[model samples]
Target: MGGGQQYPTTCFNTVIKTVVLAGLLAQKPFKHIAGFTNSLLKCYAPDLHTFYSETMDHIHRWNPNLRCNFSATVSVFAAATFNFRPQTITFPHLDFANLAWGWCAITALGDFDPNKGGHLILWDLKLIICFPPGSMILIPSALICHSNTSIGSHEKRFSFTQYTPAGIFQFVDNRFKSEKEVNSTEMSAEERAARVEARKIRWAEGLKMYRKCPSALP
Candidate 1:
């Protein structure tokens, strides 16, 4: 007797996107959403609804490296919405403080490999929480951080992060000085290589952000 074949992989792309976009729309400004939608349409091609509803579905089913787990998928869309917010919104003493929030979401076409593409890593801190696929991760944006691991050959990485007003305030690297501001000149080749190596090791060991909402901040 013939037997039925098993499924190759689960399709979670659409579910994740729907959840993230819903969450973003609930909080973000309407003008920001419109601008984001326009950019998204151009990037995905065939327009917003078509890309999200149809093309995304088709690619997730057939494309190899383009697919991602549920959490990664949702986090990316959430980040995208957050990143697309208008610049008119005022913040306290900071220049575009989006990166301050440690909470970020990313999707890789395939497995997490450091040598090939960017991977998630907690900067200047250790992992406090890790939300694998199917698990939700909510954290104080300033307390947590993540980086993208490398993607496989010919694959793409899509990701973004969210930050509340305070998280932005906390993450601002006040000590950071641009070349124009600093007296120092160029760096040695050896120093550049060392920085690259240091970055590699940083991403190799994964870290998590602690859970805390903006309302709880002191």
Candidate 2:
């Protein structure tokens, strides 16, 4: 969580991941996590539940062997990875693995000034949002370029993030096959054209899902 490393990448080392995952399962902190995610989905992204269910259902149908990270009642997927930042400023970047249509939830914790510290910077939206302790936000992480502003040197800051990877859904859809295998599959010209068109439709649908949200920043 520290060392200024980004996760779902090497920055989140194995030791930290193992400890955090074990704690979550043993403690069942998902009560708070689930409550926050569901409330945000209901208020800002009304259609998110439908989208998440549909995606998960599709994955289950294609690959029965695959399992979602979390129970259906808790989260859309097991939290991809949790990021723990301690009074550190992050560089602006987009999450490549997150689904463009899915929302990622982030909650701030620890002691920091609300008015002048630990603000969220949404580069594309041009917003420097106040992020007070215990406050959470749900946004399309894969689509938005975001980072955090600096907190006071003496004050402490920490945050927890939850997200699902689009690649996981794609993997399930491919019947648990690797990406290379899926790409190597043979297809007729007509079939290839149809597949390409289908991808375009799905991409457009994903964009619409983001646009339809009443509050994209929440």
Candidate 3:
């Protein structure tokens, strides 16, 4: 709802608007899940969460007319997805359109035994995590290769996810304009060269935002 690859502006999905607007028919089932995931985002990735929240707020402030249900319902996340195909399994892939440093919340639901199936396969990390129903996991969807193992034939599974597109952050950072708009203006030789150098330093600074703790990786 916030932003997507196809369009540079903050917008809504027509299909989702008609279907799974989180707080549409009252906040009963989805609100609690959204709130809990928001808390976990603050707990596990305080700085990242803060950055994303503030940026999303800035986006709203910048685009006062934009109305998105997911961001209004979830607050911190820009978009939400529902994967409910009875036997919900995915092939390994990276969400390349999402923010590289941003975390995506994934919650598995319905009847599935973690021991038998429905395990999160973090291919790049060489780890297979047990994913039980109602389990919420946060991961760098754009940076990591991940998927899930198949559940039993008779078993059923559904998933809800929240995420932000890299274009959203880019939109805010480029002074409320898209990269294409920013690039349209001609840059002087010095300006171009300076920006090239700044990118390297920004990458290093970006790494610092990942807070370190003794309990990390444990």
Q: TM-score: which candidate is best?
A: 3
What TM-score fits each model? 0.25, 0.78, 0.87
lDDT of 2 by residue, 1-218 (tens): 11232212222339877677657644556457666676667666666666776666765665566444566666665354545556756789998778777788887778989898889989999999999988888888888899988888889887778776776556555566656676799979897798678778887776665444555554
Query: Can you write out model 3's per-residue Cα lDDT over 90-121, one digit (the tens) per residue?
Result: 89999987788788889899897899999999
Q: Where is the poorest 10-residue window by lDDT in model 1?
A: 1-10
User: Which runs in model 1 stand beyond 4 Å of their true positions?
Assistant: 1-118, 125-136, 167-218
RMSD of each: 20.8, 5.3, 3.0
- Give the candidate number with the greatest lDDT: 3
lDDT, candidate 2, at 67: 44
lDDT of each: 0.34, 0.69, 0.77
Clashes of each: 15, 1, 0
How good is model 2 by TM-score?
0.78
Candidate ranking (lDDT, best to worst): 3, 2, 1
What is candidate 2's CA lDDT for residue 187?
Answer: 79
Alpha carbon lDDT of residue 98, candidate 2?
Answer: 80
